[model samples]
Target: MKLHEKPLIRYATSKTPVDKEGHLYKKGERNTSYQKRWFILKGNLLFYYDKRSDREPLGVIVLEGCSVQLCESNENYAFDIRYEGPGIRTYKLAAEDQRTQEAWVKALLWANFSRLRMLVQDLERTYEQVRVDSGPRHRLTVLGIESEQVTTHLGRPVHGRAATHRPAPSTFTSEPLENFVELHERYRKEVDAVRQEWLSKRNQQHGDPPVADLVDLN
Candidate 1:
């Protein structure tokens, strides 16, 4: 949808801690550079402001259909949120550490998929009703358009029999939210397990001490 036509729903919000700085970088000559802005994830919307608890947001990135990538530490130790939405483009945000970057990624993904889960539930309910009311022999009226069959499988409509009594196959191992939580936990474990090696490789390539190099040790 168009930016102007987008809905404003605040599902969640978080920010960087004092010890761990966060930055919202806009694309410019210095794409790797960091900007001082408080990052907040509200549902699928990521907003930034000049300061904590700011009234107006500087910009927003709709995480729906967006892809995220963590830049190599040697470069900037920042992450990119690439979105194909409206006039806004990819956003490069810097976090204090790998953990922080992961946090942002996790939050953004949850927001995106959580919204999706809700949409899926709504669609499933509607599909179930249609399957029941329109039996295999009855034509279905949808959007004012009559159809020989709508769908029974949410994939195909059976022409001979209506399996309305059958409940939709349960795909989730548990509740959708619970499944997400489990996945998020798995992600954290995996990331933490590789914390040492990943940081070693990243820092080594990052020169280990880019800042200290600016000064002479002799």
Candidate 2:
């Protein structure tokens, strides 16, 4: 999906200690300290933003079968809500400072779309590996396509009813195997291209400097 077209959300947290330096007062003096913070997303997605004030957020981590949705109260008023999973309560955004809200929005967008795309690429790699390991004998028939009747390598019927009926071959022909390999390679390259493009766009948006080489201090 296009970046602008995708839904955006925000979540933030902040903390302030009552005292930064330890109290060096009378022995009977009482000192109490506490932290105040909260987090929310897309105007209604709320959660406890637990983190240190000096550190960037670890980010929103979605679990298995989790998904985000955009709901509208009116024709033009909409909010992005994230679901934990089926039949679970959703987290909503809460009140936050303007700067915190903006930062959260940026992080949310990156996590929702860019991170998700990376995960898709990983899954694609796993799928390609499984396909390769399973060999070429497996045929994927499209729905509504006619099923072909063929004989197995052992000279038994593949799909017809008979006393000696056996299953079809598990591997594909040399030509099909080569084609599959080529397609898998092309898909990997495409994924890499898209990832690089995304990284470039993110760097431009954030005004981040290009990666620097590591120095050997030793």
Candidate 3:
């Protein structure tokens, strides 16, 4: 079995109050209002939600949305779609926590990449089995032959039919190995690109000299 590339599928859904905020609501908090919504960002669809708490500085709500982008330069994008009762606000996560955002960004990228890898492996196995089953001569049939003066003959079974071959164990192993290798390579490249993007955005936010500037020649 050989692993081949396939398009990635994204699954997105939303629920009222969302997961995290819902937990908080269950904790006897009456002053907070929570709402959940779903929408597509770039190309990937995600669930976005937040809870409003009545406290000084107004407890901040973290709204999140994710999507996959095919553009070589941008493989995925995520943003916060913030809403405060009657008014709606949209903000890019990149704008906040410039120094430590890569951790979160990498996490999301890895999750999506992992799902794509699993799908590829499953597809490869199915295709390989199908090809093996379609081989020539599924079952042999006996034909009559002339005997004596009469053109009559009897037919009998010679060899028992072979059971569908259980695709060699090796075949199953090879496909996933190849898929993992390819997936790892692709994921590595994508991760690097995404990390670099984050770094660039972070640098832009601070408008400081590159990290190299902080190094002393002494």
TM-scores of the models, in the given order?
A: 0.48, 0.27, 0.26
Candidate 1, residues 1-218: lDDT per residue as tens digits? Answer: 11233234222232432222255444433445565677666557776667876655655667775555555433334666665558866666666555555566556655665565555444434434434533444333433323333122122211211111122321111133334344334333433333334445557877774222222211
Candidates sorted on TM-score, descending: 1, 2, 3
Best by lDDT: 1
Which portions of model 2 show Cα errors greater than 4 Å?
1-80, 84-86, 127-218
CA lDDT of each prediction against the hidden true structure: 0.46, 0.32, 0.28
**Tens digits of per-residue lDDT for model 2 on 53-111?**
42333233342222333232221112233444466544333212334333443334333
Ranking by lDDT: 1, 2, 3
What does each candidate score in C-alpha RMSD? 25.8, 24.0, 27.5
Candidate 3: where are CA atoms >4 Å away? 1-45, 52-91, 135-218
Lowest lDDT sum, 10 consecutive residues, model 2, at 20-29
When 1 and 2 are scored with TM-score, the better candidate is: 1
lDDT of 3 by residue, 1-218 (tens): 01121211112222222222111111103422222222122222222323333111112322222221111111022222233354443332321232222333333333333444455444334333433444432221112211121111111111211212221111011222224445444433433444445456668989965553221211
lDDT of 1: 0.46
